[model samples]
Each structure stands twice: as structure tokens, then as C-alpha cells.
Target chain A: MQNLRIPGPTPCPEEVLKAMGQQMINHRGPEMAAIMKEVAEKLKYFFQTKNDVLVLTGSGTGGLEAAAVNFLSPGDTVLSVSIGVFGERFAKIASIFGAKIIALNFEQGKAADPALVKKALTEHPEIKAVLVTHNETSTGITNDLKPLASVIKGAGKLLLVDAISSLSSINLPVDEWGCDVVVSGSQKGWMVPPGLAFISVSPEAWKANAESKMPRFYWDLAKHKASIEKGQTPWTPCVSVIVALHTALIMMEKEGMQNIFKRHQKIADFTRKGVKELGLTLLAEEKYASNTVTAIVATEGLDVKKLLKIMREEYNTVLAGGQGPLEGKIFRIGHLGWVTENDIKVTLDNLKLALPKAGFRS
Target chain B: MQNLRIPGPTPCPEEVLKAMGQQMINHRGPEMAAIMKEVAEKLKYFFQTKNDVLVLTGSGTGGLEAAAVNFLSPGDTVLSVSIGVFGERFAKIASIFGAKIIALNFEQGKAADPALVKKALTEHPEIKAVLVTHNETSTGITNDLKPLASVIKGAGKLLLVDAISSLSSINLPVDEWGCDVVVSGSQKGWMVPPGLAFISVSPEAWKANAESKMPRFYWDLAKHKASIEKGQTPWTPCVSVIVALHTALIMMEKEGMQNIFKRHQKIADFTRKGVKELGLTLLAEEKYASNTVTAIVATEGLDVKKLLKIMREEYNTVLAGGQGPLEGKIFRIGHLGWVTENDIKVTLDNLKLALPKAGFRS
Candidate 1:
């Protein structure tokens, strides 16, 4: 019953949750269209894009798939920069689409070199798109998408960014940043439950959709665009989530995007400072740290499982451990969405008490 | 607003709606796993299939795509029987995956003939799968899936049924009817909000998945199955909808599946008899009438639009118009899910008054 401190499904505001609990409406009705139109406009404002924003009913991974399937064709070469688990997921998903994947793997907690991505594009002029995860949630590292976008723009290829965990918390100018396609989810910084995923597609990406041949139907961008033009989706959407998203977007607008971003930065900085005061080593480089979450490396052979268990059972706080190869080596504390400085302080306080119980000297 | 009485997105039970309003939870946590396990088990009972049922965070169309992309490879042949709008969607989606489609077209108000499907399959032995809509909401026609299953079984090809509007309201024995893949949605007979799509896959469908060359990531059946084995999903699901589904399934079990189907049939029969008594003509033949919804043709040139408008504004009843080619030609009355005999009687009473206002002779 305690607050959700782990990355998303972050703690949604009571008003937003209650908005979803409202009576269900007919999806094809005009009432639903009003909500959809309002949410779509507000999302465009948040994404900083003049182009259409299409909402799909799925997770962040679904948004990633939509970006790939909508732009790249089978046998097309795609360069993916793998900084952590999500970046690797992008590579895996692209390969599943039969895209010739050219992955630029970096260290676990390090950012990918944009220069390497440029070199890959130079080596393979056949590459149609370069994929990057803007914020690698697994390691709490934020890759410099601007630099990567510069590299991609220089090559005249498309730039696709997975901004799932960093969209609202981080400063992403989809148009000004020269990104072709940016995908985000509702559960992360949007402070909504998991169900809706969105993508802001540039004109160039829309052009790419016409020729892409990776086989798509429900996720087809062209169909989605056509439906959006008429203020509808190709099929029924998650009306409850859409209503919740409309409320969340209105809240975001009232808070101001810049202010929200700065609040996330402040909380993340406070969390990092608090953890350092506890003498713990952060996972990623300070310069490349993400504002949404912070990954902490377990030092002195600490029992991470016991630490996480104590945090959950005793303090009633649920923190996430590293995924895939980094599992048990580190744990993550998410300070995104509705989280505040007090939340960060409380989590740090829990860590202060629970670490020693797990045989860690703090 | 008023209640949703359309075919899909029927009025959700109060408990189910409140369940979706529950606080969000981490999708990867133990609590989520427990809910998912219970949901999967209950779904098996409703589907009458011991086979695993995977839930996707999309609409019913997304579930259909999951079956298409996960089972049939590019250049694979599929026989799609199109009796109404949704059937054509099946063929179109299959073709999007590069499946060689053999569409067997039927009149709008008629059910697809199993003999025709047998003939098509006999002619096209290369067809990897047979796609059919169990209940065509557009035409209010329900195909005899049992006989169609025999044809598909004799052809030794996989059968994929779109039971989105029919499941739980009609008799669909996955094992007895020999359906290899059956797709349903939460908005339909499940009495939940629109978001989650459920699909039951047989071992035979799994075998097809092994060799499927279609590109897929988010709709990967194997990934869902692997995660479901651990009582998890590969990605975050529509958590609120899952909560709603869990609550709805509990209620469904208490009512019992047989009684649920019979209740729908009773409502359908009552509505049909009432419409006939009012001198209205039903769209589909009586033998092939759909239990979920009743489509009534606007005989004697009744203004379908005005009728629907009057019913909505005057009576607060939301009736569905015909889709695709039949648009504005008929009005559909849904009798599925939480719909009762009194609901049907009230709808009939409204139609009797609204018909005259729309300039109908009756």
C-alpha cells in the first residue's frame, strides 16, 4: 500500500486514477473522441512536435516495435546503439523484424559513442535508420541523443529514439533535436498506468512509412494517421487509459514541462547526494546520469537480494534490481513521476537502515 | 453519461469498473503474478481450453494480428471467409503479413458456408491456416464454427477463430470445435474496459509459430508463453484492465458459463421476437442469428440515422449502426455480457417509439 518508488508504474495522482475509474464510454462515440482529441493535442505539446502523435494500446516495447515496423523494411540495415538492457531490447526487436542489425555495444553503465554510430552508418550506406535509447533505464544512463541525431542527420538517415523512461523528465525537443521518431509510454514520466504508448513522427518518418515493408496491420502508422485525421483509431482503444492520460496531460501542462523536468532533476540530484552521503557508489557516470532513476552498484560484496527483501518487507518500499546481466549486482531507485524530495529522503532513510542488516557497511 | 449498449464496450459491471480503479501495481511484482495466474486459469475455464491464454495490451484487432503474425509466415497461404466487415479485416491483416489470401466472400446478411470453405481449402492445399469470424457483429450473423472446424480439420490445416464478440456469450468449444487459435477481447463478453486482448493457442498453433517467418516482437506468442510459464508477461500489460478482467472473471464463474451463454441467447431471442412483433425484419437468418447482437434491417425505408439519434437523445439508448457496406442501412442491438431481459425489453420499447419518429410505417 506504500507509494510506488520503483520506475513505472509510478505513483499516479489520485485524481488521475479516479478519472480512469469513471464509467466506461462507447469508444466510437463522440464523447470518446473529445477525450482523444484533447489528449492528442496535449501530447503534441508535451512532445514538442507539430506532427501527429499516435497513441497505441501497449507498453513502451510496443511503441518501439511501432517505430521499427513503421519505418524500416525487412533486409534494411539498422544501426542500434546498445547502452543497457533497453537498448539491447531495441536491437533484438529490430532483428526480429528481419532488419540487418548493426549494434554498437557500450559498457554496462556507460553511454554509447555517437561517433561509432556515425562510423557504422558510413560503413553501411544501406542502413536506413539508426536506433538509440535516449535514457537507458537499466543503468540510469542518459545517452546524448542530440549528438547521435547530428551524426544521423549528417548521414541523411533517420533517427529513432526510445524516450520511454525519459520523455517528460528529460528535455527532448523532437523537432529541434532533429529526431525522426520518438516513442514514449504513459507509465513512466507521464504518471499513468501501463496501457498506452505514443510516438511523435516527423514528416520524414511519415514518408518512410509508405515504403516500409516489415509487415504491420494494427500498428501500421499510415492507418493510424488516417484514423487520427478523422479523430479515431483503426480499432477500439483503451478508453480508461485514454481518459487517465487526458488528465495526466492536463496536469503536466499546468505544471509546465520545464518545471517538471527541473523537479525530476532536483529529486534525482538529491537522491544521488543522499546515496553518496551513505558512501555508496553510483552505477553510471555522473555526467550521463538519468533524472528519472539512479542505479547503485553494490559495493563490498553486499547481499543485494537481502537488501531488497528488507526494503520490501520491513520498509514496504519496492526498489528494482538490475535486469539481465546486471541483476543482483546493482539496485535502482526511481524518482520519477509524482515522486518528491521527501520520497527520495524516505527511500534513502530505508537504505540507511536496511543496508547494515544485509551486512553492508554504510 | 448513459450506459454503453453497443456490441463492444458493453456496460461494465460496477465491481469491474471499481476494480480497474484500484491502485496501480508494479507489473513485475509478486502481486501481479498472482493476479495473472488466476486470470489465466479462469480464462481457460471460460475458453474451455486447457491451452494457455496470453493477454495482450491491445484491442481485439491486436489479438487477431497476434494470431496472424505468430502463426503464418510470409508467402504462406490463408483462407479467409468474409461474411461481414470484420471478416474482411482478417483477410486484410493477413495480407499485410504477406500471407497469400483466398477470401471467400458472402452476402452481408448471410453466414459463410462451410462447404465453400472446404472447397477453397481443397483447392488451395498450400494454405497454412483458415481464418473465420465466429460471430460477425456487422451483419449479426454467427457462423457454425463446429461444422467449419470439421472442414478445417479434414483439410489438416490450422483454424484461427475471431471470437471477440462471441466468446462467453456463445458455445465455442476450442477443443471440441477444433479451433487452433481463438482470439477474444475484454470489452466484449468479458465485461471489462477495452484494452486487453486474450488469445488461446493450441499446440498445433505453437508448431506453426515455430516455422512462422513473419516479423513480430510485441505480438510474439512464444515470448508471452515463456513469461506466462513464470506467471509474468514479457512487458507491462494494461494493469488496470487486468485487474478489471480478474474481477469480471470471478463474477462470470459464479454465474457459470452455460448459464451465461443461455442468458445471452434468451436476450437475443426476446429481442428478435419483439422486433418481429413490431413488423421489423432481422438482417441474418434465424438459424444463423448471433446471440451477442441482433441486426435489424431498416425495412420500409426507415431513416436509420434518425432512428439511432432519437433512440440516443430521447431514450438514452446507444444502438450501433451497421459498419462498412451496410452503414446507415441497419441498426444493431447488442444483448451480450451484463445485458438482461429487461434491458432488451427497454430497448425494444424505445425502438417501437423511435421507429415512428423516424417515419417508419410501423
Candidate 2:
């Protein structure tokens, strides 16, 4: 296997992978109930919330859709705070679902400014909700969500957060932050493969659900909540991934969330320092850099495609290229889940060697 | 492991299970592209469709929702044909999405009559589409889809099918049957775990999609189609499941569809016959019995719950109980995907022994 360094779909542990290979079981039976009950409880530690963290079988985008449709209806005004591609994606999902969007976009590599978000809300007093991404994986910027959450919650509007790539690595306590809905996926810091997405809904979000009138059935959060309470899922779940998640959660519980967060922070700091030492420029604003993934801007005359190709083909190291407008202008290295500092050392070492070959000059 | 006999989530082959344990790879990279291309091509063989087969990362219900949302707008009249629980589910999904449903109901253990469907469409000329369930796992009754497709398509209406429990196990040639859209799940006859759903769309469905005005984003078929053509999915797909599916599909190709269908047929026949000899009555009408799952009626004075428990606890044999109104009134034996005559024999032997212990005099 190549040294995979994408933001999500991070490498899983051997125990988790082996757990995924177990035989299929009756999803509605006692066996499934035990797994669901245990997994749901343990997820509270990762989410750091007392709210109901219902699991759905899909990618992170599905969880974002669930968050949007369950809280706001057509023509309802929503302030979408965008820092990068994923932040913009949450806004696009809301717009597609009929929410009138007031987009508050920051610069590509900077986090959302809480004051600007407050100004947008004041300008559009009709805004019923605010969408925020805790981490923008595309540009490797981690939004300072506490102050943003405080501003949105102070305005008494629903706060839905896309914590897809940040929840397990970053320290965002859902209840402490007063986030009404937080959406995440299994492929990120959860140390599992992609299949399941999780959503933690506050009591305030449930209140929104009662009156929200966007057309949805499969992505219904209320149905997932009810079924999860019964130790069941409304639809047939991805049993193998859930099994894997259970194992991953157990491992997480053993390591503790605080330690996991510290490990990510340490590795990310090491990566950023190493990249600078190698004469590379970081894409993200220094203070707001993400702990899960680090983005490096391609200098002029440097072949970003050739750089990625060389890393992947010659060294068997894979990294993510920028999405949308940032495509071919930046590349990302993921340090989430099971990554270690030594892994970062090897990656940066490889980059130092490959940089010259890809036409990068000091 | 215990004998897992559910309609869907049938046991995978050892190779497929091991494949599910593979490490994560970049979903947008060439490795994933290769997997997607091969899986998409081989899926056409199973779907028996010349149309574009798109892969979506969700369960069968998500696929059904995709099928409905893509082809019809709000208040557009749709003829929803129902024989059992899953049939009703498809209509519920369409109804939730704001389609005006003209439900054509058939008796619970019976197949949908083509004549009745034709009559409903004739009476409801405003109906733009007809929803059919090729196999109803809840009642172990497979609809006679070819004739029903003929009647619905003859009227120039789109025919959307829920083949969740049938598909590869029983044959429904998408092109020949004129199925405008066919939805299936990975947990069924695919011999893989749940988490992915396959949808095949014909030219007629795409035309309908152009005019269809339903609020959707994550379940968007157009986005999925565009991305799939480039050997990618609209969302970060369930990588491990897709890897396992590749292995499962390879096994299927080697076995061939004809032989697979025949195997399901033979095992189903053995299960039905074995149940009859054990003095349990089948719930399905004789001619419409499903090859995937076999539902047996709970005889009077028999403790159905106790019977299932005895079978599970003593024999390590798991089976499905009925759903909705049929709950506790029937028990089902699944014979789809990786099942054999000997497996059926073992399950039957357990049931025969457990039936008496649960107060079934015979």
C-alpha cells in the first residue's frame, strides 16, 4: 500500500480492518443491538456531546444534507460561512435544498471571522440558521468555531456545523459549543473506512425538525434517531463498517480523546515545520492551520501534477491535490487517524528529494 | 459463525470478506478509478442493462429515493404498485418527496397483477411513472415484472423497479423488460455487505430527470452519472465495500449469471419443500414465490417468537421475522447469495426440531 495522505479515508488499524472482515449478522438482532448501543455510547466521547449522535450509512455529504433539510425549509434564509471548498459545499447543499443563502466567504487559506459572521446575520435578520465547517480540508484551515458558535447562538439562530474532518482530531465539544447539529463521517479521524456518517442533534435542532418542510425521507434524522434509540437503523446499515467503527471506537476510548487531539496537533506542527524547512510555502494562514491535513502552495514554474505523480509513482506516497479553483495550485498531506511523527518525517523527506526533480528551485 | 439467513445482507464469500479488509486508497486516484471502471462494467452484466449503471453510496432505500426523485416532480401523479412492506416503502419515499401517489394494492402474500396495474394507469392518465417491486422480500413474493413493465411502458410511462432482494439472484433484464430505472442494494444478491446501492437509468429516465423538479443534492443521479463516467463517484464512496464488491463480482462472472440464478432457484425450491414437509405453511402464493427469501406462515397456537428464539439459540440458525402487520405472524428463510442445498437442509433440520419445541404440535 502507498503512503496514503488524503484528508479523509485515512488508514485504519489492523484490528479495525480485521473486524470489518467478520461475517454479516442480523442487523435487527441482539448482536447488532450490542454493537450499536456500545458504538453510540462511545461516540459521545469523540463528539464530546450529551446529545443524540445518530449514525447513518453514507458519506459525509449525506450527513450535511441531513443537517440542512432537518433544520430549514424552502425560502428560509441561512448564512453560509465558507473558508474553502468543503465550506462552500455545505452552502451549496443548502441552496440546492431551497434555502435562500447569504454566503459569507473568507479568503482561501483563512478561517471564518466571527465578527464577519455576526455582521452577516445582522444584515440579514431573516436568517434562521448558520452553517459552519469546523475544518476546511481543501485549504487546510481550521475555523475557530467557539467564537463563531457563540455569535450564532447568541443571535438565537440554529447552528449546524460540518465537522467531517475535524471532530475526532480537533477539540470541539458539541454541547459546550452549543452547536445544534454537527455532521461527521467515518473516513476521517475515526480510523475506519468510508461508509457511515454521524450526526449529533441537540434538543434545539429537534425543535427545528418538527417544523422544517424540505422534502426528504432517506436522510431523515428523526427516523435515524428513533431507530437508533431502539438499537436499530431505519434502513439496512453497512454492517461491516459499523463493526469496524466499533473496534476503532474501542481503541479511541483506550487512547482517550485528549491524547488523540494532542497527537494530531504534534504531528501537524512537525509537518508544517518540516515543509518550511524544505523551502515550501504553506497555503493556510499560520495560526489557523488545520491539525489533520496541511496544505502546501505550489510556487511558480513548479509542476504540481508532476510533483504528485513523482510522489505517487516513484516513492509510493499519495497526497491530495486541491479541489475546484485550488486544483493544481496546492497539494495536501493528511496526518489524521493512525499517522505518526515518523510518518511525517518520511513524507517530508520524500518531498525534499522530489521537489528538485519536479522543477522547484530555491 | 451462525447461519445468517436474511433476505439481504447475505453471507459473503471468504475472498470477498478479506477484500473488505483492504486499506483505504484515494477515492479520486487512478487505483480507485480502475476499481470503479471494472465494478461499473461488471454491474451492467448483473443489471443486464445497456444503459448507464451508476453507483451510489447508501442502502437500497437511498437508491429507491434516487429513482423517484430523478423521474418525477411534486404533484406529478405516480402509480405505486404494492404487494408487501418493501413495495409500500417505495411509495412512501415517493410520497415523502411530494409525488401524488395512486396506490394500486395487491394482497400481502400475492404478486401484483398486470391487469390491475394497467387498469390503474388507464384510470389515472395523469400518472407519469409506475413504481414496481420486482421482489418483495417481506412476503417472499416476486412480482411478474416483465408483463407489468410491458403494460406500464406500453402506456409510455416510466417504469421504476425496486429489485433490492432480487436482481442477480433472479433475472430481470433491464433493457428487454423496458425498465426505465432499476434500484438494487449490495447486501442482497451481490454477495457483499450493505453500504452501496446500484441504479441503472435508461434514456427515458434521463429525459424525465430533465423535467423533474424535486429538491435534492446528495441523491442527485445526474451528478453521480457525470462523475461515474470519469471513473469516480459524486461523493467519497465506501472504498472497502467497493473493493469487496469487485471480488464478489469477479466470483459472479466466473460462476455466470445463468448458473447463479439457477442455484438460487434450486435452493429456494428446497427450502420451500422442506418447510412444507416440516408441516409449516408458506405465506407466498405458489406461482409468485420468491427465489431469494421464503416466508412461512405461523400456524395457530404456535409461539412464533419462541420458535424463532429456539431456532436461534439452540441451532445457531438466524431467520427473519415478518414486518409491519405481518410481524409475529410469519417467519422467513433466506436462500439468496452463497447459500446451498446443504445449507438449506441444515436450516430446515433446525426448524423441524425447533418447531415442536415452540408448541407446534405437528
Best by DockQ: 2
Model 2 chain B: ten consecutive residues of lowest lDDT: B300-309
**How many steric overlaps are in each model, in order?**
0, 0
Q: Which stretches of candidate 2 lie over 4 Å from their true place?
A: none
Interface RMSD of 1: 0.9
Task: Give the per-residue lDDT of model 1 (tens digit) for A162-273.
Answer: 9999998899989898889999998999988899899989999888988887878888888888887666888999889899988888898999999999999899999999
Q: How close is candidate 1 to the true structure, as a TM-score?
A: 0.98
Model 2 per-residue lDDT tens digits across residues B1-362: 79988787899889999999998899999999999999999999899989999999999999999998888899999999999888899999999889999999898999999999888888989999999999998999999999999999999999999998899999999999999899999999999999999999999899999999987788899999999988899899999999999999999999999999999999888888889998889999989999999999999567888988888899999988989999999989999988889888999888878888888877
What local distance difference test score does each model get? 0.89, 0.92
C-alpha-based local distance difference test score of model 1: 0.89
Using TM-score, give the best candidate's number: 2
